[model samples]
Target: MSKLFTPYVIRGLEIKNRIWVSPMCQYSSQEGMPTDWHFVHLGSRAVGGAGLVMVEASAVSPEGRISPDDSGIWTDAQATAFQRITGFIRAQGAVAAIQLAHAGRKASTAVPWKGGATLSTREGGWIPWAPSAIPFTDGDPLPHEMSLDDTRTVIRQFEEAAQRSLAAGFQVIEIHMAHGYLLHEFLSPLSNRRQDEYGGSFENRIRLPLQVARAVRELWPEELPLFVRISASDWKAGGWDVEQSVLLARELSAIGVDLIDCSSGGLVADAKITAGPAYQVPFADKIRREAGIATAAVGIITEPHQAEEILQSQKADAIFMAREFLRDPYWPMHAASALHAEIGWPKQYERARR
Candidate 1:
């Protein structure tokens, strides 16, 4: 039997397969509410046979958005808007998941298609917040240094968002601690240069992320699993790396985190990275072995045999594909064919399955 097509369980949740749709931002929302575009974009993947179809990185608060158009779960109206999308995913036999995120120093930018530059207050951008007053790049506006109260507020925001996610019919929630976002900004010394307890030491730097995790886990039902996405390496010396990631994973696991969605290098713009197929699988393998927890491998992973090999060799517990899924929403169905696994196709598409 192909491990990639095998049923995987965590807590009380049994995902249909090891193939999962990773969160990919559409940068398409109005006032933090999802539209018909989101419904079709996410629902197509569920119908296409992914085990778990995750919504994009949804900001927990307005100020946490990477772009003005980013999705949010800060209000009841927004959560209600997500019900139809989640319901469709579940009905299609795919687990519905969402990533709760706070962009921090990276907040308030034009959408990627529109050049992705920083927007000023006149242009509808707010002052971004971070561990320190540093800007992501030299020419960018300096982010407001988050005060102690601001840190507490962020933890509360995550807790509240988890509540909203459950209300919205989501079965899984992945904390967005990866990329160059808020939590990651605190993890990397290159971005977080504060002298407070949230910075200056490994234990101190991880304080807030852990606090958010603990807060969410405490409020989130024990029957459900919690996942965290982390940048295993910043790809620069003196930045967050696999070692710190292993340690962080252990801490998160102790606090009831069920899996680590391992990815790498987004803390800074110029960090030297050598990317290729399965370049990030090593990070997952190392963290899984060292941290003694489940992990999801992501980044440039394409093809059926390659994904199966990663699982068969125990490199990662599951596969999280982003861009590849965009290319073929029915990737899992095609992969099952390649592996000679007799998985069922949706009834409506049965004629094409042969």
Candidate 2:
């Protein structure tokens, strides 16, 4: 039997397999609402046989969006719009998940194809928020340093977003604490330069992220799992590293977080990162071992045997594939064949299963 094709249980949810689709931003929403593109983009992956299909980094609030086109769940209408997508994923035997995020200093940017440059308020963009008034890029405008009230509002946003996710029919909620986003800014000393209780020292830096997790867990159903995606390493000296991630994982687990989705870098523009196939698997292995928690390994994890090795070796509890899933939405189906694992294909595609 293929370890990658095995069912994994967490809380009361049993994912059909270990192959999960990573949250990849589509940059195709209209005023934070998912359009037909989202339905098709996500629906195809469900049909493709992933055990879990996570929607991209959706903003908890409008200002939390990475770009004007990013998805949002700040309103009931948005939550209602997601019901169809989630229903389809469930019918296809795949769990539907959503990643709630705040872009922080990275907000107010144009889409990638539009050069991804920062936009000013006059140009239809709002000022971005961050732990410190620092710009992500040298020439970019400084972001608004979040005040105490701002922190409280953010916590409320995450809490409300979690409720919306549940109402939207999602079975899992993955908090986006990675990729240099708002929560990540507070965790990394490189970006969080505040002198208050939310900055400086390890405990203070983690205060807000912890609070958000606690608030979300309080309301999220106890039976459903909550996952957190973190940049296990900033890939720069004197920045957030694996040791700190292990500590954070422990705290999250205590607060009822079920899984740590491990990915590295994205804290700085110039951090020297050595990227390769399964380059990030070690981080997941270390966190799972040291933190005594479940972890999902991501980052350039392509191919069937490669994913099987990670799970068989107990390096990670699950696998999250991004670009590879985009390239081949039916990757899990193909991988099952490669591993000689007997799995059901969608009845609609049964003829092609042979």
Candidate 3:
């Protein structure tokens, strides 16, 4: 079998292939609950032969949502709703995972396709919380600076969410520490300007994120894996950079994080990102080597050979694709054919396999 089709075992869970679906938000939830839309959207990718199917950035609290329609696991009802989708994914021989997220200063905005403007409280928005009260940009609303109590509560919320995710049958739990979300806000000095133990120096900035990761790891079963997505670089001068990411990854590994899902930018609005095919693979490669941890390479990794070469070069343990998966749900099966590797088709779709 090709490296891309090789089974990857992390801890006690074995993922059937290196091709995993990156969580792309559909923004189609109802009051944070997964509807049938989620079931079909996620299940299709599983049927398409992804090794892992991850739910999008789910809010740990209502205010943590990027918009009113973002998926969440803050309630028992939402967890129950996810059961059907997880069952379908597992049945298709794919590992079911969920990305737990808190948007922080990036929250309370309209969905991307809907202009993405900041929504007022009357417009079904709430005040967003962050490490600092800074607005993402000059025109963005100033987020409320989190108090010590708020910080502790948010950590507890992540622990509770992990418990709920376990009950929902997800085998992996990925913490969203990337893309300028709440945790990223704390990690980047440009966004985190607080004067407490949760801010200032690198150690202080990483305090809350570490706490949150430890909390989740504590609740998450040791037999499963815990992943943390991180913006390897803010792509701006004096911001979160690769060196910091290496140190962070090392620290996370010490806390029992299984892998670092490497991506870039999103800490600031105007930072220039020179994105291209496999642009972010270097981050994963560097982290995996220097930090001595497994890493998932994401962003612009589309072609079959491209993914194969990434694994063959040991750049990353797995390839996470978002837009490519959205465009072709069966990219994995297609990749298998292109790479001349054998992969099984769903029994119902066997007739359609060439």
Candidate 4:
């Protein structure tokens, strides 16, 4: 039997296979609500036979949104919109997951399609917040350093979003702690130059992310899986790296995080990231062995054999394919065919099987 075809169960949730569709921003929401775009985008992955289909980086608050058009779970009305999509994913026999995010210094930007630049109120953006008053872009407006009360509010927002995610029918919740977003800002010393409880030392730097994970564990069900995606390395000195990642993974697993989705870079513009197939896989491998936890490997993983090798080597617990899935939504079905593995296709499309 193909190892990739084998089911992997986490926290009592059984995924039919090891394939996971990584979260990619859709930038298709209006006022923090999901629309048909979301339904079709994520539902197609379910229909394509992926074991798990994770929704895009969903904001936990209005200001946390990367773009004004980003999906959100900050309110019940927003959660209501997601119910339809999660319902469809479940009906199609795939597990539904979401990446709850807060885009700290990177917030208040236009969609990538619209140039992805900082926005002003006159041009339809709001003030952004971060660990420190830093600007993601050279010409972007400097964000306000989050006050103690503001930090407290963000924690509450994440707790509330976790509740909303459960009510919206999500089976897995992944915290978006990667990129140069709010939590990532906290993790990387290059971005966070504070001297308070949330910065300076490694413990202080990782405080917020761990607290968020603990809070989510408190709010999220014990039987359901929880994931924390982190940029394993910021690709720069004096910033977050694999060593720190391993340490954090140990703590997170102790606090009930089922897996660490290992990704890399994106903490700043100056860092040089060497991107290629399975480049980030080593990070996952290190954490899985050193931290003694399951992990998901992502970034430029395309071919079926490439993904298979990742599993056969015991490098990661799962493969998160991004651009490959975009290129072929039915990759899981096609991969099963290519590898001579068994995974059921959608009933409606099974008749067209080659």
Candidate 5:
């Protein structure tokens, strides 16, 4: 049997299989609330047969949203809305997870279908803020640097978000600390030029994310699992790299983080992504071995054999796919069939199982 389909335990949480649905921004929320689009989008994956179906990067606060339409759990009302979705995922036997994030310098953009440009207030978008006043690219407007008070508020927001997530019945809480978003902007040298405590050295760069993680960990139930998504490589010189990622992973694991979802790039516009099948798998292997922590491999990992090799090589504790799942919601069942792994199909689709 492919180890990729094997059960793995983290803390007290037992994941039925190794396949995970990587959090892909739905960009379909209404005022940070999960719409029916999110329900079907996420529920289908659980029905498709992944062990863990993580929700998209949910903004912890209004300003943390990647776009005006991104999902959120900042309030009890929002949490209540998510309860239905998580309930559905659980019924299908997949662990429900959420990726809590603050977009930082990457916030206030239009949805990709709407041109992905910085949104103006006139067009229903808010200004982006971060650890420093940096623009993501040459064409993007400058973002307001967050004050010390703002930093504290951000941490509180994450705490509240975590509480809400638990209330909504999410089993795994993943702090989104990577991909050139808020937390990553503080970590990457190219974006964070601050001389303050949140910039300059690695300690300063990782401080806020660490605080956020700790806050979330404290709020989260001990029996549940926690994960942190990190851009293992910024894909540029003098920016966040594998060594720094390993260092951060070790620290996170010590603080009860269950997995490091290893993804790369999105630090800056100048980054040249050398995309290929399993391009970012190396980062997962490095972090898992070097840091002695579990890691989730993401990127162009589409095929069953490719996903199997990652587990066989001890690269990642789980296989996560975004685009592949987007293309085929039944990717998990197909992979199970192709790999000859003995995972059963959803009872509703039993007749269609190969």
Candidate 6:
């Protein structure tokens, strides 16, 4: 039997297979509400046979979004809108998941296809928040240094969003602590240089993210598994690295995080990332072994045998694909065929199944 096609159980959640769909931002929301675009986009993956279909980095509040068009779970209406999408995913025999995120200094930016520049207030942008009063890039607007009240508010926002995610029928909640977002800004010294309880030293730096995790954990159902995605390395000198990621994973696991989705290098613009196939797999492998926690390997993982090798060697419990899934939502179904594994295809598409 192909290990990649085997069921993997986490807590009370049993995924049908080891291939999970990574959260990819569509930048297609209006007033934080996902439209038909999101429903069809996410629904297709579930129909395509992924074990889990995760929504993109959804902001916990208006100011937390990466762009004005980013998704959010801050309102009851938004949560209600997600019900149909999540229901569709579950109906397709795939677990529906959502990533709760705050962009921090990276907020108030234009979407990638539209130049991806930091937007000014004149352009319908608001001041971004961060652990320190620093900009992601030198010329970008400086973010507001988060006050103690701001920290508490964000933690509360995560708890509230978790409740909303539950109401929306999402079975999994992945905390977005990666991609140089708010939580990540606090973890990396390169971005967080404040002299407070939530910054400076490593313990202090990790304080906020851990608090958010604990708060969300308290609100979420005990049966559902919680995941946290982290950029294992900042890819720059004197920044957040794998060692810190291992410690972070251990701490998160202690507080009920079921899996660490390991991806690397989104902390800076010119951090000299050495990108290649499975370049980030070692981070997942090391963290899983050292922290005694489950990990999901991501980053340029596109082939069946490569994914099979990662799972079979105990490098990672599962593999998450973003671009490949975008290229072909039926990747898991195709992968089963490529690996010669007898996995089920959607009954509606059985005639097309070879």
**In every candidate, how many clashes are there?**
0, 0, 0, 1, 0, 0
Q: Candidate 5: misplaced stretches above 4 Å? A: none
RMSD score of candidate 3 (Å): 0.7
- The residue pairs found clashing in candidate 6 are none
Per-residue C-alpha lDDT of model 6 across residues 193-284, encoded as one tens digit per residue: 98989888899999999999999998889999999999999999999999999999999999999999999888898899989999999999
For model 2, residues 129-214, the per-residue Cα lDDT tens digits are 99999899998998999999999999999999999999999999999999999999999999999999999999999999999999
TM-score, candidate 3, is: 0.99
Which residue runs of candidate 4 sit more than 4 Å off their true CA positions?
A: none
Candidate scoring better on lDDT of 1 and 3? 3
Candidate 4, pairs of clashing residues: 104-182
List ranges where model 3 is wrong by over 4 Å.
Answer: none
Q: Count backbone overlaps in model 5.
A: 0
lDDT per residue for candidate 5 within 1-354, as digits (tens), equals 779789989889888999999999989998899999989999999999999999999999998998999999898889999999999999999999999999998998889998998887788877898777778877777788999899999999999999999899999999998889998888788888888898899999888889989988987888998999999998899889999999999999888888899999998888988989899999999999999998999999889999999899888889889999999998888888889888978887789765
lDDT (tens digit, per residue) of candidate 3 on 127-230:
99999989987977789999999999999999999999999999999999999999999999999999999999999999999999999998899999999999
**lDDT of candidates 1 onward, in order:** 0.95, 0.97, 0.96, 0.92, 0.90, 0.95
lDDT of 2 at 184: 97
RMSD of each: 0.6, 0.6, 0.7, 0.9, 1.0, 0.7
List model 1 lDDT by residue over 1-354, tens digit each.
899999999999999999999999999999999999999989998888899999999999999999999999999999999999999999998899999999999999999999999999899999999999999989998999999999999999999999999999999999999999999999889988989899999999999999999999998899898999999999999899999999999999999999999999888999999999989999999999999999999999999999999999999999999999999988888899999998878898889867
Q: For residues 1-354, could you state the per-residue lDDT of candidate 4 as single tens digits?
A: 677889998988999899999999989998989899889989999999999999999999999999999999999999999999999999988899999999998899889999998899789899889999888878888898988788788888999999999999999999999988999999888889888899899999888898999998998988999999999999988888999999999999999999999999888889999887789999999999999999999999999999999999999999999988999999998899989997788888878988
- Candidate 3: worst 10 consecutive residues by lDDT? 133-142
lDDT against true structure, model 2: 0.97
Candidate 3 or 6, higher lDDT?
3
Per-candidate TM equals 0.99, 0.99, 0.99, 0.98, 0.98, 0.99
Global Cα lDDT for candidate 5:
0.90
